[model samples]
Target: MKLQKLTGVWIPLVSIFFGLLAGAIIMLLFGYNPVAGYIALWNGAFEEPYYTGETIRLITPYILSGLAVAFAFRTGLLNIGVEGQVLVGWLASVWIGLAFNLPMIIHLPLAIIAAIIAGGLWGFIPGYLKAKFHVHEVIITIMMNYVALYSVNAIIRNVLTDGSERTEHVAETASLKVEWLTQLMPNSNVHAGIILAVGAALFYWYFIEKTKYGFELKAVGYNSYASEYAGMSVKRNIMVSMAISGGFAGLAGAMEGIGNFGYMTLNNGFTNIGFDGIAIALLGGNTAVGVVMAAGLFGVLKNGALNMPLSAGVPHELVDIITALIIFFVAASYMIILFREKLTNIFNNVKTKLQKGRGK
Candidate 1:
């Protein structure tokens, strides 16, 4: 069991190391100093207190988005519409925050709940279609992404516009900002959302690892037909799984609306956070701890990329290339395993021959 757990951890770490090595090789080929570039990247992400806080702020939404993808993957579903869910959730939360004048205790939670419900409803459509009509979730979700983008834009234009591309700022009571935290890390956007993100990760770990429903979910994932034979309602599980998955993504949007941005603005394109969550989920092996770690790594990369060109004379696109390489290596993990096994066999044979010669 210990060895298996170690392997799980090591595989992703090894993939990351190889990805960096590939990036370094590319830098060398381009006459860039890989060491200096990495040093600058590290400094940009962690050298200052403000940068550290900024990284954490970025990580907050990433953690939830990653959890959203990971949860669906674990349940044998692919939630490709997390981007749409996030957009709608952002609008829902921001609308509630602006519309209400309640106290902090009530207003804050209400906005969050609205976001979750909006995202859940969005997910439910595809889930229901898949369950009732055997429709492919991927296609429905892709279509929903456009629907969400256009619908939210229309709604913003018609109802929420304040003579600007964004809605009015959320009320102070609905905000997640902690004045002390911001003061502590000057110029950083740290907020209570980080706490919520950590809490959500813990809750997800407990729910998926220690509960009976979690087992049912996993059982269905492993084999839906067998789970149905054993009396589990696969359809119900699918819907619930998607709802929960979407709720996580919605929470990510809530963090942006109520914590980071304090408003929803017109987006000409997807925020890309939800799409990045797919990479996070893959790099994380769809595990809670892995997701958190992967999110942090990605946060650092994104935050530091801005400084790469100025500080190290390396193009910021190098980070994107590195990320793509990491994903490639992760996707080709079976090759890594086969290579390891072959090396292990070679070492064993060599050891056996040396021992026989010594004994003779």
Candidate 2:
């Protein structure tokens, strides 16, 4: 157990080390000082209270988004439609927020529920198709992303436009902004969404690790045919898993619509949060705790990248390169394992030789 824990910790650390090493090599080849660039990156992300709060704020949605992908992965599904779900959720949340006026106690939950339902419905389509007809989910999801993009744009232009390319701001009751938090973290957009995200993570961990339904989902993931043969309802599990995943993604959108931006605007392209979630999920090993930590790391890199070019004369794109390298190292983890095993064997052989000489 100790060995397993150690390996788990070291693997991610090693991947990060190699990723940074590769980035440094690239920077050297391009006539940049990696040391200065990294220092600037660190300072940009952590130098001020405002930057810290911003990083935390960014981490909020990333946590939920990463959970969405991680949940789907644990259920043996790849939910590429998270982007679409987020879009639909954002629209639904903003629409409801603008359409109603109630006390914060009621309005906030209502808007959140709207977002969740919208995202679930969007996820349901692909889930239903995949379960009922064995259709490929990846293709359906990719196509649905475009559908969501155009659909939301049309709605904004034709229905919600009021001389702008966005919907009206939501009422204070529906907003997730905490005035005290904003005041406390000056120049930061801190909101109550971080609390929600933490709650979601706890819920995810509990449900997946402690619930019977979660066991069923994992069973199906491990072997759907075997699970079905054992009388588990594979189709139902698939739909449920997808809906839950979509709900998480929807909550992520809610953070943006009601917490960060307080409105829905025309999206010319994918927001990239869902794509980033993919990397976050992979880095976290599709686990809840892992996801949260990975999200924080990503949030730092993203927020820090903004100041790298200005502060260190380094291209911000280097962060992207580092991120890609990290993912590549993770994907090619077998190489790391092989290298470790070779080192272990060599050490053992040398130890044996030394002991034999001593005996002689």
Candidate 3:
């Protein structure tokens, strides 16, 4: 029993260690100094104030997006629509930020609220369809992603800015400038979005841990038929879950738009933030603390990947290999769990046989 419990906790640690070992092996195979490459990557991620801020910046979006995916996972809904929700959220935030002439406090919150609403509505479409017509959410979400992409581009080009493929730069009043972010790294676009992400994480934890609604969602997730028989509205829960999940995804997009870029431009196409969130959620096991930590890990990797090629002569592609290996290890953790169990059983058997022989 103790061995089983220990295995539960140590499995994740072992997976991470093995993943790093695999990454090092790959680096050595490629004729690179693995230690130096890893050092360079770590230093690039943390050496300077600017790089630290960049890590936070990357983490901010990951936190929100990861929460989005995790939330749906908890509710038994696979929210593949987060990509579309993010795009719509970006469009809504920039459109409102550029068009409105409100004060900073009002404008910023309004833009965020609008983005959340837009994302929620986008999510609600799939939820309602699933509940009412039994349409597969995966197919709907995939189609909606492309729809949102094209729709946003069209709005930016035709209606919003006269075929410019971008919105006017948001007014200065609407930027998410915070003193700490600015003081920590001058000229960096990092801002209060980090606070927003943290707040969202806390809120999600509280919502799931301390609310009747949360219980309903979980019950529905485990078994909709049972939940319905037990007096919970499964349909309502589904709609609510999707809305809340998409709202988080929307906030991720809004952070990138208002806090980082201060405008919506079609230069980068869709960022795949929603899809990345799926990976984050999977790696984190759909838990609150796990999601936050996974997001931070991803942030560090991304920040360091940028500097690896230039500094260590280790191609940036190595980072991709590292990340892929990490994900593979995570996905295959059952093997580690099995190995641990077998070892524990063998040890116990040996201990028992020795004790019996001594008594005889």
Candidate 4:
């Protein structure tokens, strides 16, 4: 049990270490002061209450996006349409936020539910087509990303506003920005979304690790045909998995619309949160606890990178390079496993020789 726990952490830790080392080497080659750069990063992420709060805010959506991807993976699907799901979810949430005049207690939950349902329905399209028509989800999901991008822009221009570039700000009743949290982390855009994020993580842990449905999902993931043979509803499970994955992704969109931005605007491009979730989920080994930690790591790296040029005369883009290296290392973890085994064997051989010498 101990070894299994250690193994779960080892791959990501080694990947992060080598990635940072390689980043330092690159900085050296480019005549940049790596130590100063690192110091600046550390300060940016944790130097004051504001930066700390910002990092936490950044982590909020990442956790949801990672959970979205990880949950789908657990159920034999790759939900690449999370970007679309987030777009629809954001629009839906903000629409509810603007269109409603209810009390805070009612308005907030209604907006959240709207977002979840919108995103869930968006995901259902691809899952249904895949399950019923035997179409590949990846192709449909990728195409839907462009559809989402254009559709959001059109909706903003034609429907949401009076042909304006952005929607009106959400009502305070529907907003996630609470007075207490703002006072707690003054001058930061952090909001109550962190609470939602943490709660969602707990939900993910319980659902994916503690429930019978989770086992059936994993079983379907391993082999759909076999799961069906064992009397599981493969098609129903697939659709349910995608919908749930998208529901999580939709909540991530709410973190942006109602929490951070408080409105929806014309999106000229993808939010990239869904794509980043893929990397986050991969690094996290598809585990709930691992996803939370990985989200924190990414949050720090991204938030801290903003300070690099100002503090150390280093380009912030180096963070992207380091992130890519870390992911590459993760992808090559088999080599790390082999290296560890070789070292273990060598250590055993040396211990055996020393024991023989002592006996002789």
Candidate 5:
């Protein structure tokens, strides 16, 4: 068991090392100083209080989205619709913010709940279809993403605003911003959403590791037919798991609406927040602790990438390439394990032959 856990940790760490090495080679090829570029990347994410705050702010939504994807993965479902769920959640949370005029205690939670519900409902549609008719969730959820993209844009233009590209800022009562926190790192977007992210992470750990429902979900994931044969309600678990996953994603939108941006805007394309969650979840090994760590790494890479060009004369796209390479390594981790085992056997065989010859 100890070795198994170590293997999991080593796999991702090795993947990261190889990815950085590849990035360095690429930078060398392009006549850029790799060390300088990495230093700039590190500085961009942590050297200044403002950058640190922004990186934390960026990581907030990533944790939730990572949890969203990881939760679905645990339950043997593919929730590609998290992007759509985010749009609806953002729309709902922002709408509540725009429409409400209540006390902070009531207004804030209300908007959050609205977002959770909206995103949950969006996810429920595909979950229900899969549960009832055995549909492919990937296809349905992919289509839902486009529908969410267009519909949210339309709603923002037609209903939320009078044909405007963005809605007015949300009320301060509903906002996640706190003056003292902002004062801690002046001009930073960081807010109380980090608190929520931490709490959600704890909740995720407890639920997935401690609860009976989580066990059922895991069992279903291993073999849905077997779970059904053993008298588990496979259909019910599927729906509930997907809904829960969607709720996490919807909360991610709440971070955007009330925490970072404090408003909604029309997008010409997908923000890729949900898509990125897939990679985060993958890198995280679908664990709560893993998700948080993965999200932090992503935050650093993304926030730092923007500074590469200005600080080290390296294009930000290099970071993108590095990220892709890292993901590739992760996906190919099975082959890595196999290769390592093969090398180990070869070494053992050589050592045995050497010992026999010495004895003779």
Candidate 6:
């Protein structure tokens, strides 16, 4: 019985442990020292100050994007357009940052808000279509992503000074910089954005777990017909959920603009963070806390991969293989459950005999 209980608690951890062991085996096959590779990974991610800053930098955008995807998942929506929403948010922030001549305090926040609004509005289009015209969110969001991509590129090319493909650097006062911290960690871009991401996560947790509207959204996600029968307005909940999801994604773009890059340049390809957010959401299990934890784990993995190559001659791509294995094991937890059940039955029989002996 004790063994069975122990297995139940440790199954997931053991799965991850085995996954890492398998990853180490692959490293050995490649003539790399697995220990050295992992050590480097650890040192790169946390042992040094700069690397620790880098981990936080990587985590900043990931947290918001994870929240975006996780929020949609809670309501049973697969918002594939986080990429597009984030792009539009980026464009909006850059545009506002460059076009406005307001004071630093006002201008910076206004730009950030503009990004959020743009992201929300962009998301609203799909939500509205889904609610009214019965259009599928997946298809619409996918198409909209392309629209945001090209449209942003065009705008950047046409409106900026000398037709440059980038916006003017945000005003010094409007920037999200801490000169003291920057001096402490020279060349690092970590800033107040981490606070924003944390705040957003906390707000999301409260909204979903404590609010009536959150209940409506979850009810609608579970069953639209049942939600409507329960007197909840399903369509409204759907629209609200998408809008909120988009806003969170927009905040992600704003963080990139204000905290990381400082100005927007249209990238011709997909922003990989959007896709990464999907993995983060899945790993986090569609909960607010889960998303943050998952993002941290990914942050470690990303930083660690950079270190592995330097220390052990292991390719950074090996980290991807490890991540894949973790996901696979998590998905196949049913086997763990089966093994636990059999062990539990055996333990119960043993316990029953022990009880009989005590009674006699």
Full-model lDDT for every candidate: 0.90, 0.90, 0.85, 0.90, 0.92, 0.83
Candidate 3 TM-score versus the reference: 0.90
Highest lDDT among the candidates is held by which one? Answer: 5
User: Tens-digit lDDT track for model 4 on 27-136?
Assistant: 99999999999999988998988998899999999999999998988787998988888998899999999998999999999999999898888888888988899889
Q: After superposition, how far is residue 117 of candidate 5 from its true place, in Å?
A: 1.2
The C-alpha stretches of model 3 lying farther than 4 A from their native spots are 1-11, 335-360
lDDT of 4 at 256: 94
Off by over 4 Å in 5: 338-360
Cα displacement (Å) at residue 236, model 2: 0.4
Error of 6 at 150 (Å): 1.0
lDDT of 2 by residue, 142-201 (tens): 899899999999988888775479888999999999878888778887789999999999
For 1-360, candidate 3 gives per-residue lDDT tens digits of 797556544555566678789989988998998898888888878888888888888899899899999999998999998988998888888888888899888999999898889988899889889888889888998899899998888888887787786677887777777786789887667789899899999999889868999889988998999999999988889889988998998988898878888888774456978888998887777778778888998888888888888888998888878877777888788676778789999999999999999999
Of candidate 4, the 10-residue stretch with the lowest lDDT total is 330-339
Give the range where candidate 6 is weakest over 10 consecutive residues by summed lDDT.
Answer: 4-13
Measured against the true structure, the TM-scores of the candidates, in listed sequence, are 0.92, 0.91, 0.90, 0.92, 0.93, 0.88
Model 3 pairs in collision: none
By lDDT, the better pick of 4 and 5 is: 5
Higher-lDDT candidate among 2 and 6?
2
- Using alpha carbons, what is the TM-score of model 2? 0.91
N/CA/C clash count, model 2: 0
What ranges in model 6 sit over 4 Å off?
1-15, 334-360
